[model samples]
Target: MKVIGINGSARKGWNTQSLVMKALDGAASMGAETELINLYSEPLKGCLECFACKRKGNKTGGICAIRDNMRPILEKAHEADAVIVGSPNFFGYPSAMTRAFIERFLYPLSSYMMKDGQHVRLLGDRVIPAGMIFTMNADPKSYEMMNYQATLGATTANLQYVLGYAEQYNSYMTLQFKDYSAMNANMFDGDQRVYRHETQFPIDERKCFEMGRRLVAKAKELNQ
Candidate 1:
């Protein structure tokens, strides 16, 4: 079994990447080969609407034809038994890199053809369990007030529709800075942020670990 993790945060080894790594560690514990790809490590662009993947009788084989840095990442994502994508929320949505990655990743696998009144996916009947991780500065209440679920939920919904199964996990009130004293952002209580980071982030990590293990198990069962 193979699982792939995508970290869409520009800051490496931060909250988003750390959670993704924890999830990958959980997958590895299940004896699954796992890999983590940092989206910021390479330059990638969003889907250009080239219609290459939409062409009838095209030889693209369900892969994007853009021929960019994301192509190989998309190929690996498709081949994996499970995939976990982690990104920090920006303006109530995932970061630009995450959006770009998914635009290329999911669009190619999507099809206009309908079956049983449902849109067909190039993935066929294969079940590839996937997870989305979002880290944000808003607390649970603020998140609810912002209605972030509607924005982020769309990605999870599309992943499920295209890849068979998908789940989302959000880490609320994430610590955005290592040294808050240096930054001019005084709206937040630095001590409270550190306290929450020390206490709540571990719980989030554990939950993400379980999510990883559970997704791998689900993939094994469904794919079998």
Candidate 2:
């Protein structure tokens, strides 16, 4: 079984990447081969709306018509038994690269036709378990106040609709910088942020690890 993790954060070895790597480690522990793809490593674009995939008898099959840096990455995702996408929540949503990746990855696989009250998926009956991870500086209360669940849930809903099964994991109050004092952002208490990172980040890591393990287990059950 193969599971892939896509890190949409530009900063490698940071909170988003750390959690994704932990998840990949968990999948590896469950006897699945795993790979990590960093979206920031290459330039990519969102869907171009060419509709080539929607064209009758299209030669591209279910893949997007765009032949760019994301073509191979999309192919890997299509073949993956499970996929985990991680990003640092920017403003009220995921990073720009994460959103672009989602568009390029899902738009081709989604169809306009509906049957039995559900849109037909290009993958047909294939169930590829998927997961999303978000790291944010906002606390839980701010997250709720912003109605993040509604907006973020919609993204996961689309993933579930296209990919069969999708889940989300969130890490709040994430450390944004190694030396907070070095930056000019004075809205937060640097000491408290550091303390939170030292105390709570490990717990988040463990939670993501379980998320990866559970996703792999679900993929096994579905593919069995």
Candidate 3:
């Protein structure tokens, strides 16, 4: 079994990447060969909206027709038994890199054919388990206040519609700095935020690892 983890964070060794790595480690422990891809290192562009994938006589076979660095990564995702995608929430949604990658990855595999007067997916009936990890500086309560839940819910629904099943894990109130004094301290309740980071971050990491293991287990079960 093979599982692939993709990190959409621009920073190396940051919260999102660390969580994705832990998930990959969990999958590896389950006897699944796992690989991690950092999008910061790749030159990925958003979908061109050329509709080439929807055109007749297209030869790409459900793969994005774009010629870019993300093509190979998308191919890997298409072939992998499972995929773990991580992105830091930006402006109530995924970062630009993550959103672009997902658009390019999913658009090609989708179809606009009408079935019973409703559009239907033309992608193959393959079931690929996927997990999404979202990291943010706000707490769960603040997430709803920021209206991030709607964005996350839509993204998860799209993934489940295209891929057979999808799950999400969120890490809230992430620590952005080692020293709160380094940034604008007046804007935040530094004491409470720092305390949560010091106390809860480790628990969130454990949850990421377990999510990875569970993702692989479900993939294995489905593949069997």
Better of 2 and 3 by lDDT: 2
Best by lDDT: 1
Better of 1 and 2 by lDDT: 1
- For every model shown, what is its TM-score relative to the native structure? 0.97, 0.97, 0.93
Clash totals in order? 0, 0, 0
Per residue, candidate 2 scores C-alpha lDDT tens digits across 1-224 of: 89999999999999999999999988988999999999999888988889998888887757788889999999999899999999898878889899999998888888887889978778877889988999998999999999888877777888898998999999999999888899998998899999999999999999899989998999999877
Which residue pairs clash within candidate 2? none
Determine which window of 10 residues in candidate 3 has minimal summed lDDT: 118-127
Error of 3 at 122 (Å): 4.1
Better of 1 and 3 by TM-score: 1
lDDT score for candidate 2 against the true structure: 0.90
Instruction: Tell how far residue 16 is off in model 1, in angstroms.
Output: 0.1
Off by over 4 Å in 2: none
- Model 3, which residues run further than 4 Å from truth? 115-123
TM-score of model 1 (CA atoms)? 0.97
Ranking the candidates on lDDT from highest down gives 1, 2, 3
